[model samples]
Target: MKNTFNIHEVSNLLDVSIPKLLLWEKKNKLVPTEKDTNGINIYLKNQLVDFPIAKDVFESKWDEEIKIKPLGSYNSIELFAGAGGMALGFEKAGIHHVLLNEIDKFSCSTLRKNRPEWNVIEDDIKNLDFKKYANKVEIVTGGFPCQSFSAAGKKLGFEDTRGTLFFEFARCIKEVQPKIFVGENVKGLFHHDKGRTLQVIKDTIHELGYTLIEPRVLKAMYYKVPQKRERLFLIGIRNDLAEKNNDFKFPAPYKKVLTLTDAFKKGDLFDNDVPESIGDMYPARKKEILDFVPQGGYWKDLPDDLQREFMQRSYFLGGGKTGLARRLSMTAPSLTLVCSPSMKQTERCHPLETRPLTIRESARIQTFPDEWEFVGPKSQAYKQIGNAVPVNLAWSVARSIIDYLNKINVDNRKNTKTILQSESV
Candidate 1:
């Protein structure tokens, strides 16, 4: 019944050599073990359960803990804001929000309902000119939709990227000329169109006189988010800003991993039990079929005849087909919450209940606080919650940005002093 394991057991389970484990311990890649009076290393068993090594031994080493410096009152403007997930995170990190641009009526309403003081723009981004914010905002952030560019012509430029939301995002960056800019997208952006999509984005940022910081795919689970969502983070420092200092780094990963229980029950994530709310209902036939799935079980748990009827040709295909009729496990993070948690192709049934997770349940899994409410109908609410960046994940990233900005400020002061002394000489 014990979830935790010892260091030796972890070494054996991971098939990693003792020397490699020692190296990991030294590099801070593995959890530091407690030491006895005799200096013997002892690791907690539960810590090993969610360690990255146990999940995928070949996983990259990008999940190191990030240190963040607190920078108070740093001004920021967010574009393509959806239900304020990223904005909430930045606020938690002590960043000041000057404006938030969101095109969805429901989402804009949701923002206003929660934080009436926020300057929420409810119009299309293309219609609004950001010239007024020139040299005013310190940071510009957005989660622009990823779209493929025409390959027939030269590499996509700012003009060619027109008619796309990313172009609008780029336009805002140009107009504001913020010291730093952060853009996020799905992991698919990395491989979209043989990687040309990301390449063009980087080139465009360079054209705008900003230095791209080797964009990376940040895993939500690593940052205390209970889902397996991966977001591509694009950070750019204005050329002038980068020349002043180069010590900027991303936020470090949390020491612990969160699970479904963490989201719904009293724990580090939430203080009270999840509030009961309205959710989409399943049809009679689908409900009857889903009733058979046990906690953590999926379509494979159904009767053979039922499997054939439900899966159709997909049953004949390869792999585990894990997502089909999948009931979540309380011990691990919930699978990515989709707009329709009850759909057959991407079912996200409650671990105990036969029905889909409610709108509030979905929001909790994304790290949205209990007070934050979604707007519009049940479906639109689900879409906003499902599409949001995990608020805690955003806080971690924002902390890193604040640290970089502090370093920039310090360097600027030093440079200014040197120029003053030179002119006097």
Candidate 2:
């Protein structure tokens, strides 16, 4: 049937990996109008574009990556710097980290442990003053936890966001007055408070004399992270620079979609297989029930008796509870990592073993390098890794920002030269 291509079939037809296709769908590029009984995406034939362009976009990853380099030295200040995933990635992209701020003690410890040279500020964002960094930092970035602004005010400007963490983020941007600012958060912010929240954000950016590039949700899997995590990015450029030229580009997707095999086994993602580390263990009964579920399978794969025992009353409820008793497939990217792996509604069992993923395994899934260690207890380490942006994904975004900043730097040089020429005349 023309409309019968499942996810696998589409992957083969387009020569793109399953994760890339899913990323396209997330951006509303190639939406599957239907799904098969097995819950696989069923794409229609008419939805596809020509094969040549599709191949170019999906296959030219390495070529695009080789072109990403900073034209000039750029410095950045990072906020909500959880375990330094984004900050590290930016550093790898040739952007220097002038400072990093985080409220979590364990996460701050992790940042300091890995990069002692970094000015790691371990304090609440509200207590800090960003005015000193004005004109000193070119970029400001953060994965600010999403919080709704109060609707009690008439205008949804900077002041309206007060009493929320986002206000602190806004205050930093206003004070620092960086050339560019990047704010990352969950995808749900797009629709939060029936879209009023994002509108307020846009309004606040305008009030701060910056132009907002339309926010986009990037899938980490497409950027070499072996996980299905997604984050929404809001990028703003100072109005003066934007007025002169504003051409910010989002990063290109990597060609290959990695899997748990790439993560846990010796392959492209890692030099050695996942190392031994502390991990959570399933209780006796939970382990017994999950043992029956096969790789890539979930609650439906279990026998009727075990399913009933595991799901309890929810088994009789509607909708497919796929995450229940789920075991990751070695062939596909792992599901989004949460603060804890053994959560009942979102179980993250190992593909082969009957236990939850170890702290190192979780970090690897988030594309955090092995040597980039996490501090504190196992639970805290897991929390830090789970809450981080994928390093490679962050690197991709940073490269794009660098590209734009390079252009700005060239423009600035030209302007100075023109002014000198006129003065001599």
Candidate 3:
């Protein structure tokens, strides 16, 4: 890959906006190298690499050899497995799914329709007892929704969260006692309830005999997903092994960012162009109105009167409602996906087309393979895609877990052999 880039090129490469780049430039953090013949400023790769965050910036070229799958026999049990996003990532990482639990019937159908061999358990997580799986799988994972607790007397234990789904997640961890468990949720959970919720989660995991690592918000763009979605992952290593190993590092970020163009076209990310599929559409009036909104423009781009008509009372409100009538740019990563792209507040207008993203397009943004079919109505399909942890992001995290589990297996073998030798003597 070239070691130099122009200002706009750097902005696209780093997922940083032009204004932010200008600010960095003013701060002497992002300096330019020599200029090209057209007088456009060129930035050497070394210049951006000086910043800690952008240090790994490089062009993304997919290599079949760099793909990491499971190193050995590792099994996992998943909860709240909506549409199989996280599970599919682990599947690519080489972890076999012994059983997957999902309460949504449509999501469960989607999972089974795609992977019939999987044991898809469709029931509320609270109804199921995962105790039977104790020692059965090396890992347990879930993307549980966050909920507030009563803040009843400091050290939050498992029972204190009884009424919440997070409690169910903790209960599963306690019962199954896997070597490690992964919990994922939206980034807001880290600060939900003014941080009490996250503190409670930490305390509860400790009470269940697991050591919680500092929660990390992983960016999807850095992990091969062509969207700027961010997910927080909570990793817990069972106390016994945690004390022995003591460290769990996250996977390294990829050097390059993946853009929507990489996602939709026949390129490094996919063998063929994105397949056409059904998606929701705006009303006739909306279609006519959206037709006037230029590519990369949003509701704010509309004429003054139309803006007021489109945004209603929100037109008079303060902060920029940037998502309104927003059109995506192909050169950059897509914005975080909402459940329904055509929703009034979150209009994801296609870069060239005036329509919302199609089902397959959205799935591609979420990093699902083209063959992975989604079931149910278009609305349900959208919800499933929106709710999923981007598969590539999950796969990135899973690689670290696989590395740790492989180490634990090696240690276990040594311990077993030593015990046998001692008994024989």
What C-alpha lDDT values do all the predictions have? Answer: 0.82, 0.87, 0.85
State every prediction's TM-score relative to the real structure: 0.84, 0.88, 0.93
Which of 1 and 2 is ahead in lDDT? Answer: 2
| Model 1 Cα lDDT, one tens digit per residue, 1-425 | 34454554455445454567789888887754576566645666555657554544223232432344454468999999999999999988888899999999999999999999999999999899999999999999999999987751486667767778888999999999999999999989988988888877877898898999988888787677887777999999999988877777876655455678888998878889899999987788877888888876889999999888878899899688888988887766777778777777889988877788998899999999989989899889998998899998998899889888988777778889999999999
Clashes of 1: 5
Per-residue lDDT tens digits for candidate 3, residues 356-384, read 99999999999999999889998999999
Q: How many backbone clashes does candidate 3 have?
A: 1
Candidate 3, residue 32: Cα displacement in angstroms equals 3.7
How should the candidates be ordered by TM-score, best one leading? 3, 2, 1
True-structure lDDT of candidate 1? 0.82
* Model 3 per-residue lDDT at 68: 49
Q: Over the stretch 1-425, how does candidate 2's per-residue lDDT look in tens digits?
A: 23456786566445466778999999998889988889899876566545553344445465566477887778899999999889988988899998899999999999999999999999999999989989998999998887778862368888888888888888999999999999999999999888888888888889999999989998887787888888999999999999988778888776556789999999988999999999999999999999999987899999999989999999889688878899997877889999998998999999999999999999999888999999999899999998998998898899888888988989999999999999999
Model 3, residue 338: displacement in angstroms? Answer: 1.1
Q: Where is the poorest 10-residue window by lDDT in model 1? A: 57-66
lDDT of 1 at 76: 94
- Number of backbone-clashing residue pairs for each candidate, in the order shown: 5, 0, 1
